[model samples]
Target: MGHDQVVTSKGNDHPGNGPAVSREEFDALFEALRTWGRWTPADRGACNRVSPEHVRRAADLVRSGTVVPLARPWDTEPGPDNARPALHYMSELGDAEAPEPSVHKDFLGADYHGKAVSHLDALSHIAYRGRLYDGRTAREAVGSRGARFGAVSALGPLVTRGVLLDLPAVSGEKWLEPGRAVHAPDLVAAEEALGVTFGEGDAVLLRTGRLRRRRERGAWDLDAASAGLHVHAMPLLAERGICVLGGDGDSDVRPSPVDGVRSPVHTLALAAMGVPLLDNLALEALSAACAEAGRYAFLLVVAPLNVPGGTGSPVTPVAVL
Candidate 1:
């Protein structure tokens, strides 16, 4: 496939400036990709998921505020991909008859490791055309021993200025309804309310208020999770040079308003523009912290699992005052 073109619902194009994703940025991005790439079942490539520079930034943010954890503890069973209401997964307990004490438990019997809730979506998490990012293929990356990020880990810790766009508060709604999407105007309203302006290298966090509202319903359907930066917010973010996007809702939107579009933001941001998406974040505490401080922009830090060749991993990103 030729370079895929991504457009938002408002009818705006979001092509990246060029192929150059900057060595500095690549250093931080490649590490996360290897650990989380799906095609790692094919061939492994050497790359750094995070950069030292990013780590320093995160440290700076932590100094300003407390490090609020962002991931929910993983359970025995994983949930479906759609924005479902409740997550269901299996779990294994240490039964005396189950296995010998000598056997080490490996990520709930899967070869993968790390806390389920903490992770990063390496660029390898999504791909365009027949190749992974930079034209690497799964068949070439996967091997008998399993996938690898080709280094100590696939991604490194990320640090940057973070902003929160609280949709529920701005919309004057108790909460964002399940399946409802927060648009660009909603974002602007939140920014104005908070008196914050977006800037380059900013890691943005949006609250659709969907998860808190829907998870209680017991079962989530197509409308369970809230929609994100679709046609509504992508252009505004890209033009402002946002490096990462975070949300309490799923990063991709389903049943798009556009007939043929399937979560265009996923393609437009990660593949076309090299912008990373952080999802299912536990932001209520952090949001409260920001409200108390009367500030939104701060240092943010995120670290992903080092699982080579994985899809999206759980993530924990917190904003420091």
Candidate 2:
């Protein structure tokens, strides 16, 4: 089917056996990767990404409600390290003397006139050069008419391996200190200690375990948000061929382990490289699940809004055994 075709029902590709991707589909993906000119060096790095068939299978399970999706709670006053928009909704609208329609609204509603936070970043969210992964420019992707890819809506559906790194557990500390950069060594050590190696297409989740403390202290300052990947760490992850990098911290990169730089991770990973980074994820549940399973690897699924050319969206991601 063409990209424009809406996959109305779940499991449309593999009707019976859930969405387990077939080897044939994997081969097709390889073919596309080899032939597609828009594919970047970073995209080439992601060529080993978990097969689409894998994603389909996970989505099938998610649709069945067999996989419990942990809802991401909005952190109204997330500390300095982590800060983003909080979704809200309103059930009632106009005043007693006002017009008939009562305003029932979501903080960012999903109606024609309203806006809702999207869950995924479309390929257009960050382009390598002047164009997107599919060779389309940001200007071509956006317009007064409506939003498209590169917007929150273009990323069709994201699915792959999701891995979590509990930094505090690895460091034997209560929390990774704010402005303290997380290095590649820390990640490697954590992986060794946890006995998990992030695969090429894995969606890596980093848990600083600081956000919980921040919430407990009721301080939403930017400085309190810990758990960020340092600038040097970006290349490490890129070399590993990781598709997505997420954390409970403010950004994926800090200036250095000692220097305090903000949003460096966004610039290096999202801007410099084409790797999409997920921020402010509620990874407590995910961490628990991985620990319970005694395994850090699992099927991950995330579907971005198909808004033609949007930026980022709130992703509804899930982990399955």
Candidate 3:
């Protein structure tokens, strides 16, 4: 919890991870969390749990009406993390115009599935084995054209109550260093310490102080090491019935604990439980705002771009207090 205290584990090359888990163990966890043939409109998946009453209750939580945007800036500059930088160029300058009114137009484009941009991962974005969510075949459902089963367009605007798991603040640290693995016990401890409970149709955002750490200590490759949830933590979230999962990272502790599983959290949440994810969110401002508001629960809204047959979309979610 101190500046000198860092979470380190003993593995071959994983500096900040837990003990290595076998593929068999990970598959077992996946089966336990799998909720196939459970909901109507399988594309909506766990989002169906959110009823009108849930939205009304979430709206009532907006007392201060302070809104906090939970997205990083459009990353145009290349960095260690941003391998493919987002494109932004002026299309038409304000020069030669027919009339007195001149215009300036700019274009924005990105491959938003990576770690640099804030994005929402739909169910079709991840496929474990050869299947998408709800037993949809990956090859047949997602082709060169785009996804047909669980596209981002299927998930309309998401409005729900959000719970922020401020790990660094609870640990008395500025930020949790990369490779720190947060397990099921860590979630329980945070729930008690933060005085917030994880409920059905609620969006849980894990704040490991990723942006703060990246700003203080430069950018590093997240594929090698990152602060995120271990596979063992998925069961607790499944039991709590969370509708959405999000964090500063992509929700997988890197150099992975599970052998052969590059992203076990993505496998469990997306492929197994049909829970969408918000990745690469900027949660530092939200953390501070929640701390000042004396409560970690707030109204959270995520509106992804409606691109038919698209896997996901670049998003800028907001949390209102």
Estimated TM-score per prediction?
A: 0.66, 0.66, 0.96
Q: Give the C-alpha miss distance for residue 53 in model 3, angstroms.
A: 0.6
Task: Report each candidate's C-alpha RMSD, comma-separated, in the order given.
Answer: 10.1, 14.4, 3.0
Tell me the tens digit of each residue's lDDT in model 3 across 185-209.
Answer: 9999999999999989999999998
Query: Model-by-model lDDT, in order?
Result: 0.53, 0.53, 0.90
- Across 133-227, the per-residue lDDT of candidate 2 in tens digits comes to 44556577556764454444433566776777888877777666544567778889999998888856677888886556555553333332334
lDDT of 1 by residue, 1-321 (tens): 121122222222222111223334433433433323433322222112224674466456554446667665454444332322224434444554754663333333321222123345555555544345544564564356443422113545566678888767666775655445455666777899988877666778887664555444432443223355544456677667676776776565543433344455565565545566776677777767777777777777676656555554555676667
Candidate 3 — number of clashing residue pairs? 1
Determine the backbone clash count of candidate 2. Answer: 39
Question: Stretches of candidate 1 above 4 Å error?
Answer: 1-64, 77-119, 135-152, 222-225
Model 2 residue runs over 4 Å out of place are: 1-48, 53-71, 75-87, 91-119, 126-149, 223-225, 253-262
If ranked by TM-score, best first, what sequence of candidates would result?
3, 1, 2
TM-score of 3: 0.96
